[model samples]
Target: MTSAPNDLAFLRRLRPLAARELRLALLAGAVAGVMVVLQAWWVATILDRALVGREPLAELVLPFVLLFGIVALRAASTFAAERLGFAAAMRVVPALRRALLGKLGRVGPSGAAALPTGEIVAALSDGVRAVEPFFSRYLPATAQAAMLPVGIFLVVAPLDWLSALVFLVTAPLIPLFMVLIGKGAEALNQRQWLRLQRMSGHFLDAVQGLASIKAFGAGPRMVAEVGATAERYRRDTMAVLRIAFLSSLTLEFFSTVAIAIIAVLIGFRLLWGELDYRAGLFILLLAPEFYGPLRMMGTAYHARMEALGAASRLVALDALPEPVLASGTARPAFGDGIAIRFEDVHLTYPDGRIALRGVTFAIEPGETVAFAGPSGAGKSSIQALLLGFVGPTSGRILIDGHPLETLDPEHWRRHLGFMPQRPKLFAASVRGNIAPGEADPDDSAILRAAERAGVAGVIADLPQGLDTAIGNGGRQLSGGQASRIALARLFCRDAPLALLDEPTAHLDDDSEAMIHAAITQLKGRRTLLVNAHRPASLALAHRIIRIEEGRIAVGQAEPAETACPC
Candidate 1:
């Protein structure tokens, strides 16, 4: 999107909170204006009474009381406005986060392929966080500043037209200068945020690949890359700061000049006997008071720009299209069987790369099929399409004569279990990771799944059994153990259609053989699609599909089943 359109969309989205917050902010300005006018009028009244030789002690007491009341009321209104504004600001954050997350989910791995994980994290965290000031403080302050000046002009008009005119003419300069200075600040702020996201992405990449770097004796190179990214980020940050300071200085300079001009006019009028001493004093005092809020708003304008820059990125992410839900479709029921058929299917990546072409295949219910191919031969792509991660570019995939697109992805997935090459493990107890949420599988069921996955012995030997804590990503477990734990999770899921992607790729011969036995037991009862190149995995398949150049060449089983070690 072009910069102008992006900004308009962002502002439009924020209009609701902006309007609500502005109203509350104007209330604050009203209180501030009342306080200033009452203070000036009280002082003028007291001076007038004294000069006229009339002592009204009760009148003096009333001014003091009014002064105290205004101050207390202004303070209370400010506190309430801030509290309510902050609450409103916080309320929008979750909705924004959900919108962004939902978009990412629809985009999936293919859409996110080019986007770095760390950058997305930065946008989700720091970018969304920046909107807080815009919603809570800067936005309200801007409104209050704007209304306060106008209110002051109305109060002064009855007392002195010249003073009110001077005030009105000069007030516009403050915001004008603020906008002129802040024009470039928004662009600079955006650059700074982008640099920070790049730095975060680089750091996360370095950390994830640290093991490989150390193995290849490239640790120093990775460290140098990280250092370079950090330096670049620091430079961008300093650039933003420099622009912000200059903007603030320029706004302050203009406001000071305007206030100085007003003061000079009031002083000269009093000296030339054109105005009363008491009136001149009041105008002089009110001159600075009138510009105070504007000056504050000019200074806070940078904060608003910074917030806008950050919010723009978040808005972009949230605006991305989300997945469309199936309409008026009943949940598919796969009863101990599933048949998948791909008819002349084709898939092209977003970047125009074709991953699959004219692929045709079929899997019978209660049959085990394995896809074997070299890297980038469409094995993973086909699996992804089957799982609804990406739709086919042409042709169609069907399950039981129903088009895959017509089925609810979530409901379809519930009957399917997937174990990728690298399975994710959350930091939690073994049972919690195995069962996930509150679907309390009995102890026997848990043990049975673990046994089928060949991990029952390992869990049984642990001091806590199924209750043992698995560190983040199952870091505490060995590769084979982690794979077994993931398999155990799959068995616990017990979906009728299973998609196993190289489930035993990294395991030793003993573990692989044990898992093969488990697979043998699962066949002829559940529909299975295994993506594998290992011999042990191939031995378990009733049929093997060979993929090459985005097309399936052979999809029939051998005359006899390959024997496996008992």
Candidate 2:
């Protein structure tokens, strides 16, 4: 398919990453084309001398040896071209993956603008892989198609201008018809990619929520739904393949017909004694060679369509609104806990949903503060601002007497221990989950953290203790168990500033007590901000900040003995 201008431009932007390898591949392909001409000339000359001139085998020995060498060199050049093309594609794929992943990372914990998890996965894995063939095969073949046929015609024109005329006349038809057939295939390919992405998203969602489906006894319905998505994907894939086969057939038909026409003409002229036998045979040999690159181009054209379909998604992902990170040079000192103050902070999401409105509060260093609010009352919004996920639409936050906007986010985050309401666990051993990024954390340290989070008993009951592998998102564990594991991970971090969003959410009373004990022990050693709903959890705070409708209804220090009234 003819690529859209933006698709082509996107490809051009990535070309420089592997420019040297791509140039070498093109050089190798050109050498192979030159060898094809020389090989044909040698074969025609040897045949003419040995058969028509009745030359001795001994006299033709040098030419035979030279022809063999040409064939060997041609094969070697072709191999080099293939290897170099693959090398270029390999280099380009990693760079593209890195760029895509970095873009995703910048989206932060707030979510990738509501991008589907499956779509993100497909783009990073399947989409990036799809681009490989465009660089490796389609691009080099296109370059060869543009030059090789013309070079062959230049060589043949001197010997037989009619054959050169045939080559010139029929060459444009290959790409003309290729485009005609490819236009239909391009749409099919695009649809196929889109269907695949939807299918991936559906399947991922189904798997993640399998427990709910099972509880509702909707397994059969989910199965049917997933099957329908798979079937649609299969049909679209087959349709794309059908177009590919048709395009290949069209190319072969045109090239074969063109070669046949040249053959018939050369045979007739030779029989009429109007052409020399060697020249006639030479033109005949070069005819197929003239169409070879064009045929190769036709075969690699499907890869181009696939890459474009994938690239459209990738380019769109890159075009997604990314959070503009603060370019602050100042680094805040969090050694003795962090003093945070929000001075009339306001936060509005991209979708025009205001999460915070004129919210203002302050927390002293090493103080334990709790934000009490119903869901969507800007409690988590305050935590989001503190985490630097998104900058305030208007107003400022101060960190240790310094404007929060002036502190480097990456540096500021390094000292933070955050636990979101729906905590995520990696597919790793229980030990690994407790101490993420630590290759071989101290078992005693892991034990201490687990004990603090109250998951020590749960770990002991596991078949393999801390070495048990929790599947993706802790599928092997219950929600409460996973939440406790996340809490343990927070304790393991031991950062000076801890932000726990509903740390006791979705937990049993027993599990809640374990975590409460952990937080109580952690108090006065770090700056703590928690979004708490249960009265028992709010009681642990030295101060309770009540929020309602994005405004602070009350910000008062409540003695532990006093009950908090929401």
Candidate 3:
């Protein structure tokens, strides 16, 4: 498709996945509609026979029993429709969530970070949920509204054509007015969704940066900003709700007026002796039943508006490109370790910031190389490129004599162990954090990795040892301890190429020494690419490549001792 379709079109595309369940729900609703006609027929017959014909109460027992049975069956069918529709909606919500998460993964880190985290969270949580009612209530109600009113008119025409004419004339008014009012409600709902997204993003940003705000004594200012955003969202919500109430009132008023007109017509015809009592009563009994579906449809129409608003946001998110570059199908073997070469590599981010310019570098197989530079000197950018988190804007990254762009990113990453500057730890036990990817982790292997990373003694000191819970984001541990745990995780991977980006930065002397020792131990066993600033860390590298202002400083790629020292 050249351009993505609108929210309604997007919803239509997803209909096939839950077609069977939705069809069953429609079938149940049709049964309920038929029961409505039959129940009204039996009720009118029973009332006419008892009061107008002077029939015995016992003579109407069968009709009363049949009417009760019809009511029960109608109730059952309505319940079945509701349950089936809900089932269909549940199926759809999870599929949408999966598509969103899969898209998030394919976009990689840089692309995901480009979107607001709170807005993404809102889409995955509330946005997907708002769509449920469209499938569960709105779709079925529309079908019922279409089928019920026409069926009631057909039944009434043979008995009282004048009442049937009134039904025909007034029936369309409910939906016509429904459409008119719904247009305004839909716009309000869309604005409400946008405001909610802004509020969610602002609140999340404020909470995440609470520590910094407190440190800078900006707590009151931050709170006021958050309150303002929340207030705006609340006002948007109230406006939408007001529109919804108005729509409901308009539907009720028209349907009630139509029923009253039918009642008045039937009364005048009976009073003039032009219509039989039984026929007039029958026509009157069916008036409200005819308009019942229309009123229900009006209420459900609000759900459609809410769903359209939510689906619009979801569609916008889905339209973003997964990766700036498509990953190739090639999986190159790194039998003799990965030999990488950057040929005049240039890196520019989506935000128009140039990270690297004409930066040339090479890493020999199983070599320990350090990229030493000040902050924003392209060291981390190089690591991001190597890890396949992103591609070079205009350059070539070759791996083991194969073009990096031509290699499958997933397969290529399997051979590399990466330790980022700030590593994330899940809410799991310490042992689980160390070997997060292992299906059946070996206790001995984990202990060995932890010991190599110099965290085994620290783990032993905790009350629960390796099984201690780290809490979300490793909150139970200190920064140094968390870093060591991440290093241990890298060791457990046993990959051929190990990338450590500023592993010792911001660490205490003890933590730094422990990491340096781990580096010394793994220097020859694997190809090591480290981004370091401390002289001691740089000394471990066989060669140091110093970068400055998006380019390699001349005469800086040499022995570590002669390279620029921090």
Query: How high is the CA lDDT of each candidate model?
Result: 0.77, 0.87, 0.86
Model 1 collision count: 0
lDDT of 2 at 163: 90
Flag the better candidate by TM-score, 2 or 3: 2
TM-scores, all models, native as reference: 0.90, 0.94, 0.92
How close to the true structure is residue 326 of candidate 3, measured as C-alpha lDDT? 48
Using lDDT as the measure, name the better of candidate 1 and candidate 3. 3
Q: Per-residue lDDT for 330-431 in model 1, tens only?
A: 477788879999999998886789999999988899989888878889999988886767788888888877788888777887788888998888998889
Q: Model 1, stretches more than 4 Å misplaced?
A: 1-4, 14-36, 39-59, 276-282, 319-330, 437-444, 554-566
Error of 3 at 501 (Å): 1.6
Clash-forming residue pairs, model 3: none
Stretches > 4 Å off in candidate 3: 1-5, 52-54, 324-327, 330-336, 358-360, 401-409, 437-439, 552-556
Q: What is the TM-score of candidate 3?
A: 0.92
Which residue pairs clash in candidate 1?
none
Please give, for residues 80-126, the per-residue lDDT of candidate 3 as tens digits: 99999899898898998998888886667776776678878888899
Best candidate per TM-score, number? 2
